[model samples]
Target: MKLTLIFLIMISFLSGCNKSENDEKPEKKELELKSKEVLEATDRFGWELLQAVNKEADPGQNVVISSLSVAQALGMTTNGAANETLSQMLDVMDFGEVSEMNEAFHNIREVLQTADPKVQVDIANSVWYRQGMPAKESFGEALEEDYDAAFREVDFSKKQEAKDLINGWVNDKTKGKIPSIVDEISAGQYMFLINAVYFLGKWQYEFDKSATKDEDFTLSDGSTMQVPMMNQETDLDFYSGEDCQAVKLPYGDGSFYMVIALPANGIELDEFINSLDTNKWSTITDNMHERGLALFMPRFEVECKFKLNQTLIDMGMELPFSEFGADFSNMTEAQVFIDEVMHKTYIKADEEGTEAAAVTSVSVVVTSVGGGGPMPFRIDRPFFFAIAEEESDAILFSGKIENPKQ
Candidate 1:
């Protein structure tokens, strides 16, 4: 018998913005920068998540995560989280209060949406639920107003049709890079909170395609494999720190870029990762200087599809996932708890530039809960990566490419 996996999907896209715009006055920009607390909190949250997920990553496997996407989805869900469940979720995300957290997300999203006219950056949020299981007005309004999420009701019992509708939205938003994010609507799943981000941009300094060649890449197991490697030499922001060497490769107008962190010689990748925090990352980025360097990066495409339940738990977000411990009463009158947090990502880095897409689904099963840097001087061995916006330093996506061939 053919198995049909059922699940709820929360569809999100990166090309848009939350309807509620944040203060964008010049004075406000200065204030936002001076008050580094928001940046610190967001970076701290991303770092903690990277470490937690990295610990669970398979040895020598490629791991990619859109922390911004995941955080946005959970932050929207947090609007419905209350009391201890809300407190635990906030603590894990490093936010002092819910109001502060919402504003931070708002500001970050606003900056990203308006960052560039050449680069396609869209962010979208939505709520999908089964018919007759309508979300509470208050909860719905909070998501619709604050998060700028669209809501839709469907008969999830028609799993195939529902899957198509949900996946089609994802495909359209990501330009078909991520064709589908959900396979089936599993029983007991009542609602989903989805956040999707899609980005396509050309490098400020494109590499010479004729110069691309298959080169040897040393794997973690001390073995080598030949991969199509792209080479370039240019003036870019570079940093050499005690733990790692870093480089920033800008996309389009330079408001967005890729930061690669290569661990210093003799330092293990895991050790370098564990040593990262918001403060350290801020210092590293601030200290980078314009310098010329010869860079060789692999021309590769990779994807990761996994459930983040265990990872979130390990990061101290247990209450939201616990059926008994969860308290998402604001989302609906019915008792609900988070059953799973599903994430999917597609990324490609070639001679021209980089394109990436991510979709995160936070499933509320009648109970549920929710929810880095470079030194690249060469990424031949395992190295950490983060695609971010410069002005706000908002991390859009991050991961370690253990083996591009994977």
Candidate 2:
């Protein structure tokens, strides 16, 4: 008999400007930097994951994923991994060593959750195991102490009850943006590791709704569609590269930002995306300077869902999903392997601001796995965007916008 372990991750971001005259921005303390390497590794992993998912998506389909959410879930799961399975997971995530990974993640969560007083960021983790399942003491301690996860015991025999308990937590964390993630729980599934992230921030500079008007937006195939284009004029951090032009839209005192990159005329979106790498990304971001600009962007909404089992495998993380080759002795005495990795996300951006949410679940019976800016920046065509923090440069959410109507 084989037991399964399931992991679920959910992340959400909500943005809008509702500042009153009496509202004064509070002075926020500087976030101490301790995990520069972990930040870099996670950002690199984010780019790679986005590229991989893009390769598998149909043309013109918008894609979004929360890299931080996925990393946190996987980081918790890695506590139980051993031998080749452990090494493979670490390598795929670009985590060079395990010594400080947990500490780094904990620090990251603390900083991100409290980065900006005006912004509301919440990160929560929990573990639910079958009533009789014997999870190692060390593993539980690592989750509770390092990851700050809440532990519970559920009877898997009552599948509906189990589903409600897990899904209820996901819904609560996301503030109902994501109502549920668990549709069913099989008898073989013995445990679940879940991570949920929620973010809500008002724009530092809000767009006037009255200025929004329908405008022509060019499609990838030389076609055009009319979209509700939000217009604004202000000083913004901008970048002009050989292949693309970019802009940064700060949220709540500039600790977090949304950066948008539009491909230059003659360059296809796919072509530019394929060319993106860590070095190129650094160059683009590092070169940005404040410039007075006119900006036009569409009010768009995007939702994406993906099963990342094959994607992770293609990225060289294989053994954890292999039934016979897998080893998770550190987690439990039971012999188990991953079953699926489910991810879902939703984002809505309007004149007031943007709201986005994501959920990723990995079942090890189960196996699973798992932004933006601006400019005169007329986003009149398909472009890439990311939501990231200034201190850590940690990418919380990222995706491409092909059509606002969809």
Highest lDDT: give the candidate number. 2
Model 2 CA lDDT for position 245: 93
Per-residue C-alpha lDDT of model 2 across residues 267-363, encoded as one tens digit per residue: 9888888778779888888999998888999999877888888998999989988977888888888888777777777788887666777777777
How many angstroms is residue 122 displaced in model 1 relative to the true structure, after the best TM-score fit? 0.8
Model 1, position 7, has a per-residue lDDT of 12
Residue-level error in angstroms, candidate 1, position 345? 1.3
Model 1 global lDDT (CA atoms, 0 to 1): 0.79
lDDT of each: 0.79, 0.80
Off by over 4 Å in 2: 1-34, 366-376
